[model samples]
Target chain A: MWGGGADMADPALRPIQRDWLSKTLAGLVLGAILALACSGLFARLNTAMPLGVRGQLAMWMVPPVWLGVLGGVYFFSSGVRAWLWLGAASAFVTGVFYLL
Target chain B: MRSEFVRIYKAVHTWTGIVAGMALFIAFYAGALTVFKEPLAAWASPPVAGRMVPLADTPKLIAGVLAADPATARDFTIHMGDAEHVPGRMGWQVRDTDADDHDESSVRHYVGTLDATGQARIEASHPSQLASFIDVLHRVVGLPVDSDPNRWVMGLVAALYALALISGVVVLLPSLVKDFFALRLGKNLKRMWLDAHNVVGIVSLPFHLVMALTAVVFAYHDGIYIVQDKFVHDGKWGTAFQRQQPAAAAPGRDPASMLPPLELIARAQAFAPGFEPTALQYQQVTGPRAVVRVWGKDAAAVSPRARGGFAALDPYTGKVINSDFLPGRQSTPNLFVSSFFALHMAAFGGTAVQWMYFLLGLAGAWLFYSGNLLWVESRRRKRPRDGGEVPAQRRDVRLMAAATVGVCLGCVCGISLTIVGAKWAYALVGDANAWLLPVYYTTFFGCIVWAFLQGAAKAAVHLLWLAVMAALAIPLTSGLAAVAPGLNMWVNTSLSSLGVDITACVGAAALGWMARATARRVRQGGADSVWSEGPQPCLQGGVPGVGVQAK
Candidate 1:
């Protein structure tokens, strides 16, 4: 996970002061998108099953999946890439569901 | 850790823990007490002979109630009296007309109790809101959920909490196996705190995971259900669930001919062995097909969710209609969902489990408290032992210390005081519910201001004493009332009442002990520490420890 900085370890934890506002906001937005997309993905997979089965599995699965995606976003080295990737995934899913 | 992942995770763990610690402390502490919600409720409202109706006499009482509130024939309950839920009474549920048919809602409730001469008397009943208040405090202590949009504020916190859990485990991975049980009581307070905090955080990881994830679902269940109903189900929830019907009774059977209370309990036992019906609810009493819901607990069932297993029966024919939620008869999906509810509510395994949860809850609260302490300690700059000044950068620690002491202790005291207030509330106010907020907020804010003004070390001893006094009042007021000539003799007769008194006494004793321990720590601890009252590091600035760097 160490990139470019040979001397230092875990550059991510160095407490970057500059552009913190942007990073925080961006992380929040991207995390939310990824969470929603993951939930929709679970829902889509369960579509062939009965409604009760779908509901049950969704209840058991969705929250953790959503939370996992949310936590996963903070791992990225760059906030811009995190936002861009999550935003793109969200759009792709939204379009797929919209068409269906 | 040698890798950057450790450092990054360390930051993540630190930030998430700091952000969620305060709310989680309230949640865990209140949640721990909520395990005994029924006992607490009973303690709040002691039973009187007038309120308790014998099971054999309930039929006559129901007849009388039907005469008084004929609407009750449609839907009512003969609240089976017990030790935990004192004062057996009857309830009439009024439903909202506009809500969706399956989107169940009971708009208003009126309760009936028998008078001395066997007539039914009804009142606008208010179940003491103290247990519920504590439960809500456990859920959304900082932001009031009622005012929050989408009601997802708790969900967001839960997400952060999950992150905290993950990152915390990550940071501890280096020493996870080696230092799991090491409780070093050396001079290094930070090491001791870290060890203690990590042990608790790791040991209770399963419980915390269940709570955090379930809390999110609970907070966002409405939205999730909507997605499932509209998008997933495509508006066929009723069809998908395959609602079952009774085999015995036909339509238009008279509810008046329904099996009596005693028989209902007997039949419920037949359906599920050892199913003890605590409450008999008659639903749709006005409609053509009225049903009786025999709600109670089954000793054999594993999950401990409140309300236990129930079988909806045809009141006229005593035929079991819906026992899907019954202990022995749950579907695979039902069992799965039931397990979650059971774990979330600690509804399974009875009193012993409840006690375990209560202790773990207290431990969880301690973990958060120590997390904050570690944060404050991390920033404490080292200085020479020769009375030399350290940097003034200790103000953040000072403020955080004050806030941590103030808000956390304030919640603890506020709950205890409110329980004490229950002894006097109904007698004092026309609107008793109105008094609860004022009583709690007054103590909570007062403690906060006091902490800031007097500092955390000074306020800790005082607040602990206040907490002890407040908790003692719960048992004392009731115990002493027994000696009074005019006060009711019910508390003297009930074990639940005595249990509440005894538990409160124990809690008060614990608080008293904590106060003494804290006072000693304040008096004798290190000089450069925020907890220390020895001497302010003679830094350049007037500030105690905000920014003065260590030499």
Candidate 2:
């Protein structure tokens, strides 16, 4: 029924349709790890700013950005790429955050 | 014409929407009702509330509460129930479970008003926590009662919810211009549902964004605050807004030395001009650290909390002591933070915005519900209605259909029926508020079981009846109260109270209409669906026992 002339009913695409379990694990784990570390790092970067505005801004910015990162992961060109990109990005950010 | 990224985003939208749609539905539905929390609370409170002791005699009532219980002398408040709606109320803490900790939600409060003889009598009897109950349901989904784990659960769900919003927008972007308002209502049911989902979602994107971001902040504010404290300020942020202690009360200094509540409100005006006093909360009224936080809002000032500007006054001299976050007096950064909060809470805008947010909330609920329906529809088995062998639907789709009907309708019927119980069944229980929890949980799980036993079409009709019955009970209970015996008229004499009845009637009418439409869909609709008369009724006529009739 897809207008693309290739439906998900094709045997080649059935496996992708059934890949929900792996996607869930990747989304939950990679998504959360990146979200927390990135929010913490942003708040840290803003410590030099006057007043407590940086902290307050962190609260508003962190969640949306986290979800953006998650969207980036899932919207990658391939499922394998989605997993690899999310894993590498999450590790790099978290490792750098601790190192800095 | 869609790109690979758009295709991937479509999958992301589908998955995240499936994950978060149900919880989001409950949150949005209850959250809509919570916009008018004060009015709902006023409507549900007993008539005794309307008799609040006059502002002229508030000090006398205060003195009485202090004298009746020495512990109450620690902290008491004069609740400024507007003379028109919720008059005659004062509150005091009976016992400090956590000593000197004033702001914890767990503290037991004793609220009452003065009697005819002008005596401060503690009215221990309360009608129902209808408003607060609904607000609490919006915050936490009634599993573990707002513990940290629950907050984390909701917070993570919010993260997923945010992902859903992002992906949904991405998928809709390429066709955003031409198909923005295109609602093709003809043969394609999926197209129509998708359009409705997309239209509602796109229109309310800002509102949903604020909700998602704010939910994350609210849920993990403690952790975020800690991160700020340790990393940002080297643990010095704890003292950022700390108020300097007042001169210690001399031994034998009577608390009667403190200024009256009116004088405190007047002094608060010196800090925030045109401050409309709503409530005055006094902490440590008799102790050396006694402070009276006068909560009033200057309508001219935009505040984040629904409550107006706050001024912590020196109770003894009626002098303004703290004004850092007070509306019209807050610092720029503080004001920005407060403005963000006010945006989410809709505290800045008046009643019109409140109504707008209410409609937005209901629309949000519809978006989630329809999302779930679209998911189930996507996987429904295809077959002819007249005859031939039909395959079973996907287990996941069947389960989602049951859950979509069960959890969402369960929440609606639960809240409605509990409020009905609050109105009519209070006399039967030891505590009406306590009684509603059971009423909600029972109905919630009961609907889920029923949905599984009977499939989508039949379950939808029955559960809708339950929803209509529960909703109708609200106005019905109030209407019967006026004419019935043993139930003294608890309706407030104000038009606001009557508006609640009207709203309930409107809600019931909507549910009734929904029920009728669902029944119509079961008969003579497309039989190539689970919602239609498919197998267990694929034969020429219908199912043996069940009521599925095929043409």
Candidate 3:
């Protein structure tokens, strides 16, 4: 997605040795899972609400949660850590979703 | 954030922006025009003959049309206004079954009206699709069709845009306080462009945030609903929105027995006093679960959708079935969600708010365009101290400039020419709807090719001039229509249509000014920059940031 690392030759880029490619891919994938899990948990908690209302709320929740993950995913120092932590968070959320 | 993190975020902001900026330019530019969708539709629609049917006669018109053609009973609308594009008191659309749900271009429009004798007359009107065509471009970032795949691509772009917004704020956090609203119109072109970009982005950060989040939901809401059905609603999502059915079976309801359109509006008005009814949409009127939604705007409240909020009422009893989506009448939770839609669609605070959104949208477009300009300007290599040669610019810089010039200006020219083509196509081919896409794509691709062939510097000026001409043609077409009626073209004197022409005139003046500035830059600006018309020379040593400054 970074498209050939066109600015790789720039001195400013040399210091950042993190795995951007894997981190971005992890953000895309795990962030979606985490978003879906959050939405599922939201729906379960609001099960008593009318489907018309709850469904809309759930659908709208996905973007922010997913984008939140994508935006903050870079805070991790490396792609491996990003994947591990996001993976753990997604698992926790999914477990909570099923438990409800 | 640490300095290292800021630097990393700066890179993130740059890459994400470069990837999504051009597409967002089309989205924001076209989106700005879409704020006046009704006006654009009115401007493009040829005037219909005869006066509109009276509001009192709309019930009769609906009964007559339904009796004549029962298929229309599935869904139809009775417009309450005298807008130029309203066609008549009653209008409905028959959409192609396979067309994307958001695709309005394939829909056939029909209007029912009472003739001189008070008999129902149904006319198939070919209302121009120019407004919706531009809307489709805005929705899917210049895609011709609003299909699922295209929307997913739009979803990707929206995600990238969200990332860019976040990273951009992070990158600016250090200098944000010091440079708030700073506009240094100085010789340091790169700093000037950066300041301008930062100011727009930061000031409109909330607006862009709403746009990005809402756009993501719009692009992927269908999938989200499917997921919601599986994990959230336990696969009952499809039936949840359905109205409750009675146990006793009965034949199809009679349209004539249903309440009049005026009664529905009255009921809606009673439910929410300030909610003005613009149209009465009768859905499944003949079916057991019949619903008549009185749709309109309430200037004081937020609407759930672009068509404004609606109060769903039972056609037989005139009882309000649902006010969940009604403006000024929604529950607090529902209203909270509705605010999102209202903010994104400019469905609140009336025309003043609409104008604000329009200007903000244009400024957003300029933000992205200036980002590209800053990109090219920052990468510029300067002339050597010896003054013997001009350093050759990187291939990426030249390519980015070309793409930026091609895509952004192409969209502007394409939309303008296509808008102007609506009347001409109607005059010549007798059907304007079919010519919209072809004319737009032809102009769009032609501009892109011109950019690549002429190079960014020369093509930017040329395309800007072309854009000026195309935008100017909008009002000229209307002017000619009024003066020379023999051309079979038309002009609408209504405020909405006239507003479109006036806006286009202003747009043309802006484009004209940019064209002049760009031409001067190409002719007399920096010799070592890609924007210059002068020849590039390969040199071993060149001093950076020591040459002529750009505007």
Candidate 4:
């Protein structure tokens, strides 16, 4: 009965889920970098954009990075693993930004 | 792990709900009333004489008032009371420097008419005491006579409510996806009650959440002292306020010099770009280093009350010294905090938002009522012992029934009486708001006590009927006094009063419906019958003094 239950079967698939989580995190990081670069280029092209509007656009950077953490958890094998990955990714990304 | 998470969340939800439920009930109820604060205020205040002062004349009128009462010029505030035609007026409050004591004793010093030469004449109208009373009720809940301890008690209750909501959401998570829209009716009383509670909770979850969180913030503003001390005062806990004091005050010491009000307004406009200056002040007026402060509205901001920018002008020269708009980066936290207020108060998107909040508020009220009902129903399955000696089950029944009828109907009675008190105060003393608010609240609390003494069924029926009558009398009283015709004329010309009358009519209808429903329930259930009378009680009688009986 325990073997037939969804709970027991879920752990067998954990390794595959871990791989998916790592892939998703990598994709999100790449996407964020590209988007930031594009926004910088767009701002250079459009000089008339108000300072407030530019600031608002810049604030959009925080939410996406936060969302990537959540996305990584959703694809992970377990909540603990998901949290670990999220913490690591967040630290690395935040550190990179701080260094820049 | 999942099960453990669920268990923790369930505990949180239950405790939070239990603690915060009563305060949330009061908050949501009074907040619903506060939606019409402006109209209610107008209804409380007497009609103003003369046409509304022209926009152009406002500055002149204000100037005249300041010149006449030179003492008031130090620190003063003006309110543009309502719009024209429907008793719209203007008033001001000036600090009474003449007082011997150092404590501020500002008086409601009115400036009525601006003469042909643009001079102000003193005018007096009663303050919207009823609306203000309702506002206090919405905020602190404990009126003056209720004892000061009630405020702290309510604050603690609010915090508990936040906890309950969090715990509730946690408990619901496991079953949420499967039974998101589940509402099984017909038999299985416990299941039915659970379904009802869940449905109400989930449907109005967003509103309830925002309201709970913001209410906690408001109730526990003192908690911010921790953050203020750490972040605001260079890591020093108690000295934050002292540090900010110098910056907040006037920079210069000029007592004799004053800036041209229009120039200050113009400078403020320059800072905000599109915003109109709503208020202006000259700080340290007579000194050589006087500064003019200009404050105004920014339509793009989340709330109309959100202070956009400040422009300080050198009073003697009319030169702009500081032009500062709230920086977009720094404004994010403020925007988030204010968005909570806007969401809770339905002040952001105007009428549509107000209606949405009203519906949500009603739903929240229903959620609490249903929750209590569920508790009663769950216990009702266990039958009380036969005969005169009160079984613990029976006592539980009586108390829950009393609370259900007393608190809910008592609120209705209180609000209705407050309206009546407003009218009566106006009729008898000409200034109704002052006395009407306290009278209505007294009547409301009396109803609660009255409900407790009587059986729940009887109390419910009586108060429901009383509410219907009171609500109906609102329009009738106005009509009989010929105020209705003038009110109708005003309603045709103004949306505010029309909305007020329509809301009153709707309230009358709702009370009438409640009366009928209570009467029907009384008829079906029979007089003196307790809610917990059947077989289901036996299945869940683990608690002492409660027992299940065979049919």
lDDT preference between candidates 1 and 3, better one: 3
Worst 10 residues of 3 chain A by lDDT: A1-10
Provide C-alpha RMSD values for all models, in order: 5.3, 6.0, 5.8, 10.3
lDDT tens digits, residue span A35-76, model 1:
455555666765765567557666556678666655555555
User: List-wise, what DockQ does each model earn?
Assistant: 0.29, 0.29, 0.40, 0.04
- What tens digits encode model 2's per-residue C-alpha lDDT throughout B318-423? 8777775587788776787787777777776577787888889999999999999888876777766667866566656666787888899999999888777775
Among all windows of 10 consecutive residues in model 3 chain B, the one with the lowest summed lDDT is B536-545
Tens digit per residue, CA lDDT, model 3, B259-297: 888887887798888888998889989887788988899
**Which candidate gets the maximum TM-score versus the true structure?**
3
Best model number under DockQ: 3
Which order, best to worst by TM-score? 3, 1, 2, 4
User: Candidate 4, residues A1-100: lDDT per residue as tens digits?
Assistant: 1111235556544342334345445434543443344334333444464433333333332223322232223334544454455445446644444343
| Poorest stretch of ten by lDDT in candidate 4 chain B | B532-541
Global local distance difference test of model 2: 0.72
Please give the TM-score that candidate 2 achieves against the real structure.
Answer: 0.84
Interface RMSD of 4: 11.6
DockQ, structure candidate 4:
0.04
**For residues B1-551, could you state the per-residue lDDT of candidate 1 as single tens digits?**
34555776688888888888887888888889888787777777644434467778777777777778777777788877656344446776576886433222224557777888878787765556666667667767543223334236767777778889888887898889999888898888889888889889998899999988888887777676666666555676658665555466455544456677889888888878777778888886545567788888764675525657678887767889877667666767667778888888777766778789888989989999999988988888766777786444476678888888998899889888877776576545534455666788788889888887677788888899999999888877777677773543224336655677898899899999999989988898765676766434222234555464444
In model 2 chain B, where is the ten-residue run with the lowest total lDDT? B534-543
